[model samples]
Target: MAGFRWWFMAVLVVACWMKGVAGQARQQQAPAIWVFGDSLVESGNNNFLRSTARADFYPYGSDYYRGPTGRFSNARTFSDILGDWLGIAAPPPFSDPTAAGNRIMGGVNYASAAGGILDETGQHYGDRYSLNQQVVNFETTLSQLRTMMNPESLNQLLSNSIVVMVFGSNDYINNYLMPNIYATSRTYTPTAFANLLLNRYSRQIEALYSQGLRKFFLPGIGPLGCIPNQLATGQAPPGRCADSVNQMLGPFNEGLRGLVGQFNGGSHPGATFVYGNTYGVFGDILNNPGRYGFTVRDKACCGFGQGQITCVPLETPCFNHDQYVFWDAFHPTQAANGVLAQRAYSGTTNDCFPMNVQQLAQVRPM
Candidate 1:
């Protein structure tokens, strides 16, 4: 009887190990990539909306894929490239009819153009979905996910899934520094305003966490002041970026880093929050364009005027987008976005604190 019991235990252990290895392989091959944010990742979500901030038009997606796709870039957005890297089919936008069914199991992009950390931040853009609204949208998707799988299975899937939040640019670009508005600037200092954004950001992360999201990747804001639009509008000496706006990003990124650390250090089991130092990575690209095979990191490859506006329909794009960084007035070209996404996924701790996105996907809580 003792010998029979021992044999049974050994078989059970081997079977469990095989199951675990199979699960790991499945996760490595197809970890769901849930994205929630703003223009940097809108995909096709904003297409159904009657918003001026949408990118569902010509010349916007000329570099890759079909027309529009509701992405703000001239080609594949960072998230699209990232999905490819992760070995999963690119997630359809939440608003895309194709994503209406069980196709959502592949993940979804709830990002909207002009969406920001604050509700009021993107209001001027007309019908832009705020971060809170994005969370609400996510909840709707979660309901659908629940219907598709058993509760236990759904919980396990969500626990193993990855959530990405990319925002903050519009909060500054359209809200605080919109020239005459002076709302945020007058009400709070840079540091104070950063705290406010960070506070809201914490809530956003917590909101997602409450939904069983376990892995999080928060991409920090890039150097907004150096973007073509800011450079064109600001009083910076020729060829110099608007330092004031860029300076504001520092406090926000610092706050984000701390927030991630806090979450990781807390008692939340299976929770992994990573901060991708996009600000630093972008700055590196700007400072050393040649290292990334770029000649022009300043001007927009698809916009009209000297970095004054974005790519308009029928308007001409640059002869070679690969040589430039900025695709429009605000977004990065596909080439630049590719570099940024690669870094966020697997770069050193300097680029993605705690861990990069790839590491975040593989981690299983002890």
Candidate 2:
């Protein structure tokens, strides 16, 4: 009986060891999320910047657990919701003092409020990180990571990881459309401007690829004309969106989609580019708010008036924030963000071309 007992103990030890190995493998398979963009996904990077465009005050994050963590939404941003679905913790902002060491293993958010693809897009706001600058910051994070991890291991980590980019809206809303302030409108036609943006954007993506990054989730610009800020301009008839403003987005979005195809079909090995149809999904939500359980789709829930699109600091927002679509002049409420994230994560090809985020997350790097 002693011999039998010894054999049983040995078997149990082997079983436990195998289980631990399997668990570790599963943990390693989870992809890290690196987020970059404008106010739509800006976690708290803008707070660290001396910029006029910031949302570090009350009523901004009223629904967030850590209230007012500088997220532009009334609660979580689209990246936050998508992270929950992936079972990965939201990455700390790259500018955060504590976002160093192994903390970056999960990912890093370089998004900033009022940021844009063009360097001069949001200059009036003062000290915003353009897409070029964000990539530069990411390079800094990569340097820190290399110090802790070997080359092969770091390459594997970045190749299998996902990079989320949401840009272009600010280039239009704050740059091209603002003819008085920016020369872009006067310098280029709508089509010419789209081509210019894409040319610069292609270089940025190539820079990321050169750094060993692979998977990319690029969400296109939404319908800015439908937002309260544009609506307040009275460019459109009553209860209608600014058609002229929205029309300008078409060429840019189309060219962006083309960029995805170009990257995927190119010589770039193991590169998986997914274009998210944020415009279609957001426009659908705006047109069919009742289908999404939203009551107010025209105006913002927190701001004082159509002119003052953003919330007044310490102002009490509406109790039924979830019922409204817009949280302020330019940003969506948590409810809208949740719906958008869901569609992008698991929706059809019309929502996310080639594949959804879930499928993108499952793809193994070659």
lDDT of each candidate versus the true structure: 0.84, 0.89
Clashing residue pairs, candidate 2? none
- Candidate 2 lDDT (Cα, whole model)? 0.89
What is the lDDT, from 0 to 100, of the residue 2 in candidate 1? 100
Write down the RMSD of all candidates, one decimal each: 11.4, 9.5
Query: Where is model 1 poorest over a 10-residue stretch in terms of lDDT?
Result: 21-30
lDDT for predicted candidate 1 compared with the true structure:
0.84
Misplaced by over 4 Å in model 1 are 1-30
The deviation in Å at residue 255 for candidate 2 is 0.4
Q: Per-prediction TM-score, please?
A: 0.90, 0.91
- True lDDT of residue 241, candidate 2: 92
